[model samples]
Target: MKTCLPFFLTISLLIPAPASSAFYQWTDAKGVVHMTDDAHKVPKQYKGKATRIEVKEPARLPEAAPPEPGPAADLAAPAAGRGEASVPGGHDETWWRAQFGELRSELKTLQAARSQKEQKLVELRRRRAIFQRSRDRAAINEAEAQASADDARIGDLLNRIAALDLAASKAGVPAEWRQ
Candidate 1:
């Protein structure tokens, strides 16, 4: 009995479990079994024994609505009129007025910004001029000092040559031929 029990356990473990599907297997009136996705296909005799398989459907989302008109559309209509505008074009007065207000605000901002930039540019130009003058003065001073130093060096070299000639004369050497 114990050996038979092991065989039965192995056989049960080897058999695969039923797969998940939308179909079901049922036996018809003739006792022939068949698989089908539709429950109505099962014969009346197998309906009682047929197993039901559940199917999950994807969720559907609602569509979006069209956009509404802007504030300008409201402004073009006359005060007394309910649907159409009192004006000839039936345009919304509110929308035009809103646009005009936006333009005026933009113009004011631009004017303010322009004034600020102009003031900044003027100060920068003034500072640049001051810097240029300073730079020019420094260059002139440098050039003058360089010229004075060159003159001093030349004078020193002439004095050295004169001293050498004097020494050659005192030593009884021909100073003119002292190459």
Candidate 2:
């Protein structure tokens, strides 16, 4: 028994261990590709199309330098341009705050314009319905045309409002300022 122990140990050390997991790939009914470790998890219909996939481990990236200690460390570092200012656009905090205020104002103005246009559209639609009930073709046509124009205007205002809101958010405006 003692003589056989060393030989068994040597054989075990010489053999390579089997991989613990394998990847399988398949396409679903919606034509989306998927990968998983268990073949049984795949749908019955897709099993026939499933293919074994060999996954290679990704290479590790080099370690990054330690971050600088400051209140602005959590935020993204300023990009290169203009001066050595710390803010994103090479502007000071006061400048950014003023920009945020302007964006909020613009957003409010656009929203008000959109609201007015929407109200006009609703009124025009009501007038069109009344003309239809009275069988007045000319009146109905006029109201419909006005409504269509108002709809286009309202869509434009909404888009502008969305753009302003996005700008304000990117400027890091406070939520209370948005209101």
Candidate 3:
């Protein structure tokens, strides 16, 4: 505990010091600028002689390029296939469309499942509130039990969504479905 006290004090000091103090800078005869804690330290001859130094900020630089994909990308690299390709059938670009269609179908199913779970949770909560208002022992007990079950179901759905999120990430799909 004693060892932690000093660490805590040091961290407390590191909390942003309010901008209360003013800074003063001046150049000497040799044209070398110097800064001091006290203005009086500046020699009388050089004092009030140098121009008031206005702070000129450095120019903003352009943003850096994102780092190139490394080992991970190499390991999970997609096949060297073109964006859209002609299937053996020589019909419309059916193969490429099929992949997107499959993803959309899965997404739709997940959304419906999530919506149903949410609606059930809402109904459970409403019934629980109604039971609580009734002030009957049996009603309260039943409502509380049902609420617990609903909570467990909600947790299960949340875990399922999490697993789906990992799958979507691996499949290079966006997070919209999970949300």
Give Cα distance to truth, residue 14, candidate 2, Å: 50
What's the C-alpha lDDT at position 28 in model 1?
67
Clashing pairs in 3: none
Candidate 1 has a TM-score of 0.28
> How far in Å is the alpha carbon of 79 misplaced in model 1?
11
Stronger candidate by lDDT (1 vs 2): 2
What does candidate 1's lDDT look like per residue over 1-179, in tens digits?
98999999999999987443355555566867687888888778776555433333322222221112344445544443565534222223354344345444543454344444444444555665677777555555555454344333333333333443343344343322344
lDDT of 3 by residue, 1-179 (tens): 99999999999999975332223455677988776646677778866542222122222332332112223333333333434352222212232234334444554554445445545555666776776555454554665555445444443333433443344444444434233
Q: Report the error of model 1 at residue 8, Å.
A: 99
Q: Model 2, 75-99: lDDT tens per residue?
A: 4343334456443333344444444
Q: Quantify all predictions' global Cα lDDT against the true fold.
A: 0.46, 0.51, 0.45
Give the clashing pairs for model 1: 72-95, 75-92, 75-93, 75-94, 76-91, 76-92, 76-93, 76-94, 77-92, 77-93
Which number leads on lDDT?
Answer: 2
Candidate that beats the other on TM-score, 2 or 3, i.e. the better one: 2
**Estimated TM-score per prediction?**
0.28, 0.31, 0.27
